[model samples]
Target: MRWFWIFAVGHLLLWTAVPFFTQANGPLDNVEMLNWGHEWQWGYPKHPPLPAWAAEAATYLPGGPVWSTYLLSQVCIVGCFWAAWRLGRETLSPSLALAAVAVLEGSIYYNCTTPEFNNNIMAKACWAMFILFAYYGIARGRMVDWGAAGIFLAAAILSKYDAALLLAATLLFSSLHPRARVCWRTPGPYVLTGVSLLLTAPHLWWLVNNNFATLRYIAARSSTSPSWLSHFEHPAEFLGAQLGAVAVTLILATILLGWRWRFKTVDSSAQFTRTYLAWMVLGPLGLALAYSLITGAHLRSMWGASMFTFLGVLLFAWLEARPDPALIRRTIYASAIVGGIFAAGLGLRNMIGDSLVTAPLRVDYPGQQLASQVEEIWSQHSNKPLENLGGDWWLAANINVYHPDRPSISAEQDHDLPAWTALDAWRTEGGIIVWETATAGDNYETQIKALYPNVEILRPLEFAWTKNQQRPPLRVGMAVVPPLAPIRTAELPTPAQH
Candidate 1:
């Protein structure tokens, strides 16, 4: 347990610090979440509100916004680790449980990609908590366990809709598994259902009032190929991607238990535990694949982020592998080795990616500098503090994140502004509309004219990349919609300039 705490702390600090120092800007998803968090809505156009809410809350921490986001992501990873460890301890010996949780360090989803705080990161923690409490609720028929399970279930859904797969898995297991069938007769199931609905009601109401904007987003994102071969190809690609994601886990497990098959007979209690773990591990994955096959919908590899929380427990339970002190020591050493390698690789990528890649990576964008210049231009035209930004998600979000006022966002593509942004207020106060000159297309002027016929297209501004100034400068095109109110000559200092 002491060693586990040490590893957890080391992991949290290393991941948080590496991204903080190496990257110049937050990842796209992280910046987008921060922008949405500022709005503090019940739901967003793309995802549930929990991750945005979490990102917004993290900004209040001691570290500045970008550092706080990095820290928040690592905190979620560590929390998932703790939940997995507790779940493992319920069925396996303490040392074996420790080994099981430690091996998760090999999964890339838990390490390399985790720094980009998003719905997947939040769902990972929620999924682990949901499984842990759901297990206890089903096996023990306790009201407290059922209540906790309900809360986490609601949280998981609030984090990502994919968590519905986990709920379905739980129901499937409860109906068929002999040990879990007794839960139906108890008050546990009802309590779980009631609490989950009670907690989720607000988001559900938001969905209803907004006409399920998230579902529309999901539908738009789903790539359905016209070819019949897509049914097989998409699922196969998804399966292969998942296998690659967990390849390191298999390697680490083999290092701990060796290459030999070590199956051992267990008591009925242990057998039941193994079966339960297997369902939790495979059920969600199978359902996802089945959905892909039926609909020919292109599945994203990151969508599998929460499906493997019980993987370690299932692996050990199936093998009946008991780790001696020597093997446990080896597992700890291997975990450290893997963590160090990943940390070094990520650091190097962030530090030198610009020199190697032709185009600037997302992190290399000069967001702060661009935001400062945008604010300067807005000040020249309007006296009002920058209250709203209108553009595509990436450019608009980047500027919004660094902008001192933390203005509301109005996506260019949406016909109606989000509920958080008052249309009348936005029209009266006015805002800047921005886009990358290269990507905005030739019709950008036409598009802006259609929306704001009187919009003044400012001279395009160019800024050097953060890492490689010798590369082509980032050219941003801007337009200002004149406010209905009178203008004054008050200029607010840009935070970047300070």
Candidate 2:
């Protein structure tokens, strides 16, 4: 238990501190989320509202610290670690329970990719809680436990609609377990279902009323060719990615607990716990594969966030039949080695990435400078504060996050925007527009002019960003269209209303 807390706290600080200093302006999703969070809604075009709500809530601290969001991401990550610890402790020995969590730090999903406080990270925490509560509910037949499971399941779905894939897996497990099957007749399961539906009712209504915009966005993002070859190609690609993601953790676990597979005496209690872990982990992967095969959907690597939550427990349970302090110590050593390598690798990448003159990541974006210049230009033209921000998600998100007023975003080029504010309202209260320079033969400026024909196009501003002293500077081109008319409404959405 002492070691578990040490690993958990270390994981939290390492993840939080690295991104806080190394990332210049934070990742694109983090900025985009803060932009969405400026206004609260039941749903956004690409995902549900929970992630945005979480991001918005974090800004309530005195300074609205950028590191707070990163901290929030780590908080979610630590919650996942704790949930896995709790679940394993109940089913397995305490040492093995700690091992279950220790092994996961090496996984890229749990540590490397967690710095970005995106929907994927948020979903992981909710998914872990849902699985833990579901296990307790089914194992103990407790109504309170089942209710908590339902609530977290709803949170998972609200984090990303794809979480329904995991929920389907849970339903499959309920049917297969003899004891859990009896839950079908009890009010607990029914009430659990009701609780999930009740919590998600608003988002579901938004989906229907908006013509399932999120589904459409996902289809566009994941669309592939209709050829028969793609069915095989897509699923194979997905499987390969999944395997690669867990490769390090799998290798380390194999070293700690060799190729032997053992089962506890066919005790119903032991079997139930093992089955729950196996089914939840395997069921989702199966559904992902099925979806890939049937729809030829391009499965992104991030979707693997919840797939390996119970993998460590499964590995430790099969390898260690009896409590062995020596084996547990060895597992801890191996975990530190693997986790250290992962952390060191991440730090090296961030350090090297800052010096790369070519192919810079979003973390290198000079959002603060751009926001300052744009706002300065806007003040010259209008007495009112910047109320509306328009452009692409990346550029607009950059300005919105740092701009003084935290303007309402208007990514008009991107369709399926939720009615965070009325279009008429935007027209009445004109806003600043910003976009990158056009490449050769590109007419992004012409398109922006066409959209807002009444406004004048300001001279393009060429800003150079070089965070690391060793790197050659990056040149970014930006143009701003200052507000034409000013209208301030008492009804403008603010973080406080959320």
Which portions of model 1 miss their true places by more than 4 Å? 379-383, 415-420, 441-456, 485-498
Tens digits of lDDT, candidate 1, 43-100: 9888899999999998888756778889999998888888878878877888777788
Task: Report the C-alpha displacement of residue 332, candidate 2, in angstroms.
Answer: 1.9
TM per candidate: 0.92, 0.90
Candidate 1's error at 209, in angstroms?
2.6
Clashes of each: 0, 0
Q: Which segments of candidate 2 are over 4 A away from where they belong?
A: 63-65, 260-266, 321-323, 419-421, 424-427, 440-457, 468-498
Candidate 2 per-residue lDDT, tens place, 102-202, comes to 88877888877888889998999999999999888888889999999999989998999778889889899899778779888878888789999999999
Error of 1 at 79 (Å): 1.5
Error of 2 at 40 (Å): 0.8
Q: Pick by lDDT: which candidate is best? A: 1
